[model samples]
Target: MLQISLFRRIVIFAILIGGLVLALPNAFYTRVEQSNDARAVIESGLSNDDLSAVAGQWPDFLPSGLVNLGLDLRGGAHLLVEVQVEDVYAGRLDALWPEVRDVLAAERDTVGFVTREESGTDELRVRISEAEGAARALELVRGLARPVVTVTGAGASDIAVSADGPVLTVTLSEAERVATDNRTMQQALEIIRRRIDEAGTREPTIQRQGADRILVQVPGVGSAQEVKDLIGTTAQLTFNPVITRTTDPATNVAPDEILAPSLDEEGVFFVLERAPVVSGEELVDAQPSFDQNGRPAVSFRFNPSGARAFGDYTAENIGAPFAIVLDGEVISAPTIQSHIPGGSGIITGRFTAEESTNLAVLLRAGALPAGLTFLEERTIGPELGQDSIDKGKLAAAVGLALVIVFMGLSYGLFGWFANLALILNLCMIFGVLSLLGATLTLPGIAGIVLTVGMAVDANVLVFERIREELKTAKGPARAIELGYSRALSAIIDANITTLITASILYAVGSGPVRGFAITLGLGIVTSVFTAIFVTRLFIVLWFERRRPRTIEV
Candidate 1:
């Protein structure tokens, strides 16, 4: 008779069971749909099974012997966005320049236009527009502005707006650029978060990177790809005159540096050739609406700079048309009747309520520094993702069935014990996954299936070893002891190789691939423990209980 202690048997069983428990949580419970009836029963102190019946239970927890589901199975949305701040900044700056120019041009327009004088380094030239009017505009402006940017030539009829060496003509410094970039990035992330959350998307991850960039990830989301259109439009606002090439001579002007927008288009509207009199950058807010004429439109209000620019531009360009263009598409063109110095106004044009709201948000949030050119876009339909999940499930089931049949036929009675151990191995896998919150991707499922074969391999090795030892006519106990000792080397070699692969995959891959690595690695570990110890425990127990003459292979 072979000599093997019961203590050793108990020790093996405990290790195997412990491993199974650890992996069960992650694997079997990918999602637990809590039923209120069940919960109420529990609260009312009912048995779990009774509560389950009253409410409803799911096989959602796959049999104790399977892999966990990953994000794909759980079904969620993933979105990637790049924060293009230049579009907003440049748009804002371009918008502001028009207003500033309009106000500056007012003095000239009212002054009846005069020659510009070159005074040393500073542009201290004068005598252009009406003096009193220029003073009024400057007084309104000098009250609130961007820091202490010098406004030279503000004293005379020609208001020379300048910050001296710090003129708008100069480029931004490293610090300014960096600061601006940080602010843009910061705003982009915050705004995006708000949008995603506002859309009722939860558990999102938003990150900011190099100069005005953000990355957002939303898990457990349905109806993917819709988030893109939600984030990228620029809502710039302006007021100008409507012009058609046929009616306005400038539209048919010689096409050279400034290409006259095609007059053939019904949407084409032109105003005075002069720059915009007011910018939307100064706009504090915008809301969509229906004008008295029953056209969709957006209303807006501006900050100080915008007010002065609007007032001055209107004062000089009175009766001239101004074009309100957004993202290269002219929204409207209206003639200036009276000066608007409040920095607030309305934009009336073709727009739906949703369209208007989006525009308003975009404008209120400020324009992007640069227009977004779709670098790359991919859309995953819900049906497609769901189909993948179905296929993955089918593959897993087929692999598992084959594993069971193969083990049962080849190893005979001993195979029965191995199958049991395999089930335990699966439990170990799921338990660990659930506890650790591991997601099982398709590759991860494959790994688990592959492990079924591997777990069986260990069993086959032990069984063959025992069968070989039985040739010497040893008792079942002695045969099992020798089999386990001999098989340990092969089992170690096989499982270690799998573990190394899992480690590499985890290290190199991202997202789902990483999920695969985690589950696979976990499978290898759980497989080894259950195959080596749990199987041995049952084999030893059988020998002790029966005192069999000879152990079957």
Candidate 2:
């Protein structure tokens, strides 16, 4: 009666063998990781002979994926950054000036001359020459408003325009502010991720903390300050038309122009138009290259719209100078020698090779939505990570040893069968993790150790049930059948309850707590599978071979 079908037996063995095969690559993690990195480099068109050769070291068809280690297991930097969202509001108002001017200019006869007023940085104000025309100007500016894209803001305008005497005040509506803040936060998250990825660091945790904050964690990074520097640089590259060259930095300039000092020349300043002919957002590609004079430079190509704008501006401006500005600083001001119609151009600023490469990386990653203020930063050293890993391994070994010894002593032969299943269960956990590429943290090691003990609990329950059935005058085969049958409900119920708890922990927790929940949840599944099916198969095979009349559980 304790017989397993050929299909069932094959499935159980196949699972055990498949798990071992998949988990084998992790034992040689360094080699596998090297192969993976080499493949990435070759695929990215890096043209490294050594890397390309190493890419084939691991077979293409093998399970080469390894479990990623968390920040605690591997040394890394953690950062809490607060995005300055309000800074965007000031820039937004500045950008809206041109649109407002164009709209009001359409009805200049009715409103008379309109002048922009210097109000609070948070608001945009324009004064009408005729006080009686305030209503008409307000209506024209209000006509520029668009409907808000939020559920709570139905029928509300994007901007609130009010007429206070002759001056019309404009502020971003509550709905628009919410939308802008959300976009800023999401853009910040994506840009941070791209920057870290560009730096070649592995498995960074970039997430939004709140409405105005981001959390960044990078494994194998040298210091937290390095990550902060990489993320905090706005890298807002723009090409603005040169208004004039000036020596006075504080010269009174029009509102549409800004004065920025030259990077290479002393006491030299360039007044540049505020509006950019081409912004970094339109840049599709950027790379480090050498100029005609053999100086390091950055070559960039823009998207279609940007290419058209840049081409038209360059064709018209001919010999006029244009400034390449980055983060409000003038990097270079060069005269347009010819029309650059291909949308590609070089930026030469006496850059070193490393500087050019770094700039290119920053450009390719795109600009941050808002400047980041580092709220908290810390570095976890490799020594600390190694110590944690050693302690975790020791704990797991001790836990596994104790569980195996206890099961061997209590259940005799059946206990040894459970012990074998437990060993296979450990391999299956790692196999699943490697397959999923889940991150393993220090707390995750604790989950595995906890699982080692709980794995035998089902076996204990079944053995106890068998003893009870024997006392009820049941034969050896009947007792074994009844034991497995009746103990099924308790095993399913207990595992399901633990799984639910792990799910809640994973959903609510962040970082290491989530790692713990992941391993705990995975361990529960593997433990249940091994206990209910694998150990039963082993017991069934033994009984089938020996044909025992009376057996001791």
Candidate 3:
């Protein structure tokens, strides 16, 4: 007998109602989006009359999860940026200089006076007064070389040290350079992601394109320039020992000193040591706060190693000024009043609250390992996106209408049940997408349209089987039961094969391909549920109520 248990019917209706409720927000996407944004702001401890009003647009009891629109559907910024990985080579050598200087200085009797010499960007050159000690200096510096920390570079040293006359040159080895490049790219990607996420963007496609390039696509951003502004600042902060302050920008400086302009004071420059006492890499936390004068400032705290170094530097250099540099410009040059042991400090300057907040965000995200050169940039307009949405809606509506008409003409009353199931299947797809926070692209819309046609296949198979079974003199109930039972295997087999394909596409593909795979895979699951269970339940209910003895397909 065609029948569904009372509990099974309740479960089915509960699921259907739950899905419909979850998918309800998408029906008023704009209002719900504004409400969600306003609610987030309120939760972040900010609320105004306008924000409160906007937040009340949707009821508090409803599910607010939305199917995020992809770049193609929402319009956004696209960028192809190439990281300047070579910049790290110069910084690496600069960092290695202090170690080499200290090691050679310890053996001053043999090495004589040591001085850094001008060299290529990738190599560090140190000259000793005594030529006879060149070999000794080379040997000592070579001891500083460690094995590269990569599988392909296991046996290779990080630095190659060689001697020529009285000068010893140290350069990063090829293997180490390759490894450094990989790390640089990884770090750049992470920092970029962090910076964008901090700005509250959604569904950003940030992935490596080539060896040194990244592809960034942020949906719903105003322009590419806005995205660039968010990520362009390197935020490299360091505290350097100040040598002297000068008004002339043309002051000659030593090889180990750098002349940096003051961020707040015009025409004022500070000559500072190239090597920093502590760098921003050691900073564990940064927050927007007020300085002693109650002015907007950024408070920062360092890790243990950074704290120890910072404490030692301040203890030894009381009454001397230290320049707080960010991206090669000194923001503040404050004189040490006493030994500051805690490693917590305030950076005070002429700054507004917004600037301080943005700086805090950047500091928390850490500095980019290398600078980026924008190779390509594009801003997609909202008008174009709206056109795409309109077209996509038309395509989906047309596909749905054709499928509904075909099913109704072919399968009679059973066809109406199948059509209803198909509608619910779409609702379920949207519900699942909202629950997963999946992005919908143009290709994803195509997947939904394709699903509309495919959702009826199982019903078609069952209906045809019932027509055939009726020819064998089986009653309506027996024919219906056998039709569904016999068609189950075929339905499962066909959908399983398609699911495997969708999974593979999702695993290996990116961006639009991924969007398509997600929708297609989700559609298959929902279609099977609506076909085998939902349509069957509807038929069972009709048969139980009407108690029909004769049926026509």
Candidate 4:
């Protein structure tokens, strides 16, 4: 048994009551207008004030429930994606590696990081490519890299290789520096998220898992396949088939000049009418929409020069086909679509509303520099997660009920004090989570249960110590003080060890593991507070009223 001071009891009551009040907004139903007003801004282009106007007001309410559950509990798709670094590098490598190979072979006899490949040398063997092409890819990769050192393959091919669990590993040649791989992966994921979000998904979670793998959780995603389909394929863009060289009206654009004309590596051969026109870079904005007649189309706007060039090009090659390519495959090749002098026109395709939006997303995010593979896809059903939650709740209830019975039987009136503290501890945990906006996953619930059990254990230690202290002829008050003082060291040591593990889990674990670690760590802190402050206060208040000379244990 233990006692608490009157002042402390009042303070505890006030704190608990305040916490519950503050947490009410996170648990109640919120309106659509409120949720929409939340800060969904991921762009820095918009000014804060401008963003504020579009974002609207903050939510005044929340869902009616025991706190919002994570995607696992509600059912959604979970994906582990490996960014296609290899494809990114392959484009640069395929185009420039040839130059490297040629330069290396021509300068084979040179020295001191020379670009020379000797006869009979392995093409991939870095001894040759490194000496010759090192500076070539180095300069280019640098342009795309962050403030990181240059990493390269043994100087052979400048290609991004493949993906490991959490990292998209690029060949040293393309990366120019090991550090850039992470930056590149991060950039790729951001692009992917933008593309997915443009298709209108809400509350999606995208995070880096390991060195190369990306974890994506889309809550309430009925369009799982669509997301994967759009993301897994790399939609790249490049300006090919330059018409600048054409001077004579009868001259035709070289086949190689046409940008990637097909998936088969064939280049386009649009009639050039011996005139140069604008490049695709003139495009400023593009959106997948419907044509004037309501046909599916991609509407695009171009700069001034583009408008003039496009108008001229169309006038000269009136009947020739101009291809609209996406990622190397031509989506449509409409014949001289009538001099769109405004540089704004449509490329019609067979697309549903969702598909149209996804295409728009891809364009808006900027095309990938290379190709990508879906490689793998996995979806987690919310039903399975709900089952785990149910089982976990059952286990927790049974364990808690048993603990309560044991404490009441072993410690009598003092046991009820521990139970009261335990209840307060639970309330504090929920309240804190509500304030923090942390999602409750299945593992997180497990942590809550574990905290409940551990919280009671502390009280048991104190009660047992008091019982033993009484045998030494100490009064109830003296025994209570001694028990707290003596048990503090063990309590701190256990908690410190647990905290260390929780920290590690938070650092190394991904997704649900991280969620669990967070709840568990917070639970320890709250447990200590309730066990020490709240329980002691209750005991002190009881002592003032009862003033028992002896205590039951």
Candidate 5:
């Protein structure tokens, strides 16, 4: 006979009620989203009476999570970016010069002086003055090389150093190049995500595409150009000691220094040391603020290690000028009057409030290791997304109505129970999605539509088995039990196979494909629960209360 313990019944009802409660927020999505946003702002230490009012719109007792609509469903900008990994090669070689020079200079009695010569874009060449000391110079440079730690890079040096006649050639090794490429891609993805997140845009998809490419999709961001503008900036902030201030372009500066034009003043140039005392990567915080002159500026604080480095540099180089370089332009060149032990300072430039705010955002996001070159870009309009959403809703409603009518006419009272369970299954799908903060895309809607049809298939199988059991001279209770028990294996088998397919899709695909897989997988789980447990519980309760002696098929 069909029977359910009070505890089992209560647990099933509790799950259904919990799912309904979680799914409730989506009905008032805009207000709940606003409340969530306001709550986040208040939690971030901002004081605003209006935020309190907004946050109170959603009840505190209710779950505030809502399903995130994807780029296709909400409209956005899409971009395919290829990171220029090779650009880091020249920089790596340029940075290696100081170490190479210092090492070679120690053995000056034997190797003599060395001078850098023009070479390939990816190579570093140093011409030793004495040809007899070339072997010693090469050995000294090779000592600077370290083993690459990565799996594929095992036993390989970070750089390849060789003696070519009187000159020594240096280039990044194959192993180090692979490691550098991986690091560059990861750093680029993180910086881009940070920059977009700081802008307060919702649910941006920033992911790696293959080896060197990044795929970026920002929902509600209208134009690809806008997103490009936000992440394209290589905001490399560094404080370099001023080698000299020169008006003449031909002023001979050391090879270790670079001449950068002043941002505030025209035609003025500050020749600064190529090695930075502190880089923006070391910055812990940055915000827009006013300088002592009441001009718009950005205030920044460094991490502990950077604080010590900056403090030491300032203490030793008192009275010397240090150039603050942003990108390729010198923002300011100020004389160090005293030691600045606290590594917090303001960047003074001729910037408007908006410019200062944007600069602060970039600085806070940190610098990208390599620049991105946009390979492809497109903007999806909100109108198209709305149309898709409208059509998807219509398709789902029509499908649901047709299925309900067919099931009701075919199976009578039992059909009504299956239809009710089907409706709850959809609620559970969205509820679980919201709970998990899953994104819903256009393909995801299609998955839901597919699920609506498949959900009834298990019920149909069970109903047919019951009809067959009735002809075998079994009573209604015995027939129902046999139907459900025998159909359970087929139901589990079919849904499990489909769930495996969705899992594979989620694993291998990106963006909309993953969204589809997510909804399909969740739908399968919810449908199985409602079919085997929820629908059965409803039938058992009815039969127990009524205690029917006979039933029509």
Candidate 6:
């Protein structure tokens, strides 16, 4: 009575063949990886003869997806960086100064002449010439305060205003500071992720650690310094109104002015306004292109708001030099020959093509909200990863061999069927991983080894049950049917419990732990299918062909 229908048999064989086909690329990982890379280049419209040759290493008809290797397996850069959230406070205060100046200037009759006063990094202070109108100055500044947007900060004003004599002090409220900190962290994480993705790295782990720390692990990068060079630069680009050109590094400037060294000329400096006409945040697109002289340069376009502001500034300040600043340094100070209306401009400097391309990428990714201080950095070598891979292979092979030998010795011919199912179960695991584009770590390899033993456990349970049923004087066919039917509940119960544990691990854990959980959970599913269905199908075929009347357990 134990039999598989023709339809069921076809389904089983189809799954086996499909899994094997999907998993075939992993057998030629290096060749397939090169082919994939070359294909990507070709698709990006930058293909060459060498790239075409490399892409042809693998057939076009086969699946090219691969199981991505984790940082532990592929070697990469690891960094722990602390975001300087306080830096954003200073920038916010700087931006608030122009609005405060304009507001107080509107009430010049009551508040008198207003000038920005030097204060703490987190506070903005405005001094009025008339001490009697202190209350009026404070009231005007407080009017600029907006309600914080965060739930916890609801009803709280973003800026707290107070008066001391003729000086009006403005600082971010406690709740607003907390809200800003959260926003800064989120923005920093997003910018870092974009920068790494723009660089075309695979399987990067970019996540927040504590309050201000970010952990970055980029697989396949050359070194930690290389990664630092990629993401560390704030790339804060701005166009500020140039006050005057100077050769002195220690030139005195007003509170609203900044003295920045020119990037092209060593000793030449430019004194510029602290507030910019348009910042990098308003940029909509940036690309690497050649300037009029055919030199490497970066071209950029602005959003609607940015275009309006840039157009107004250029129109009003024709014949005056406008400083293009990047992270506090004046990269270029070019004279505005005419009004540029379209909000499109080119930045030309002493740059190689590669540098210009990298600048374009950073510009497109947007600027980081805050500065990053590298707390720790490490570069893992591929040699170490290769060693780990070699050891992991040895352990998995040894465990698999031992399990196969034990099953073959214990249960005779039925054991051979179980061993074959175990092999297919592993192939299915790889197939699923490849299909999902999962990363494989050292711990993930251990999960696969553990699965090799677990894969045959259901077979062991069913074989032992058959031996017991045979002792009860049942016929071979009846005993085989009862054995599988009786063991089904136990097999399902055991695998279900393990799968729950794996799910929990995956939900709460990160990096290596998640890798292990993924492999373990996937292994449990494939193991149950192979043991209960594939092995049973094989036994059913053998029995149907032989029609044996009696059998040895």
lDDT of 5 by residue, 16-78 (tens): 999999999999999999999999999888958899999999999999999988888889899
Encode model 2's per-residue lDDT on 44-75: one tens digit a residue: 87866788778877888888989888899899
Better of 2 and 3 by TM-score: 3
Predicted structure 6, TM vs. truth: 0.96
TM-score of every prediction relative to native: 0.50, 0.94, 0.97, 0.65, 0.96, 0.96
Residue pairs in candidate 3 whose N, alpha carbon or C atoms collide under 3 angstroms: none
Error of 2 at 505 (Å): 1.0
**Which regions of candidate 5 deviate over 4 angstroms?**
45-52, 249-254
Cα-lDDT of candidate 6: 0.94
Clash counts for the predictions, in order: 40, 0, 0, 31, 0, 0
Off by over 4 Å in 3: none
The lDDT leader among the candidates is 3
List, residue by residue over 446-506, the lDDT tens digit for candidate 3: 9999999899999999999999999898899999999999999999999999999999999
- Per-residue lDDT tens digits for candidate 1, residues 1-553, read 4445778777777766666655543332323323433554576566766666644543434323223344455555555556655444443333344445455555554433332333332222323345445454444333323432224323222122433211222123333344555666666676666566555443455665445445554545554456666556544444544443343434543111112332225644453332344556567777666778876767887777787777777788678766676765566566788876677677776677887777776776665544443344444455665677778768767877888888788877778888888888777777676555455666777777667666677788888888898888776677778888988998899878888988999897766677678867877887777677777777667766787765556
Task: Estimate the TM-score for candidate 2.
Answer: 0.94
Whole-structure CA lDDT of model 1: 0.59
How many clashing residue pairs are found in candidate 3? Answer: 0
Give the 10-residue window scoring lowest on summed lDDT in candidate 1: 254-263
Ranking under lDDT, best-scoring first?
A: 3, 6, 5, 2, 4, 1
Per-residue error for 388 in candidate 1, Å, reads: 2.9
Per-residue C-alpha lDDT of model 6 across residues 1-553, encoded as one tens digit per residue: 7888899999999999888888999999999999998998899889789999999999999998788998998999999999999999999999999999999999899999999877888999889999998888888888999999999999999999988899888999999999999999999999999999998898799989989999999989889999999999999999999999999999999888899999999999999999999999999999999999999999999999999999999999899999999998988999999999889999999999999999999999999999999999999999988998999999999999999999999998899999999999999999999999999999999999999989999999999999999988889999999999999999999999999999999999988999999999999999999989999999999899998988765
Give model 1 RMSD, 1 decimal. Answer: 12.5
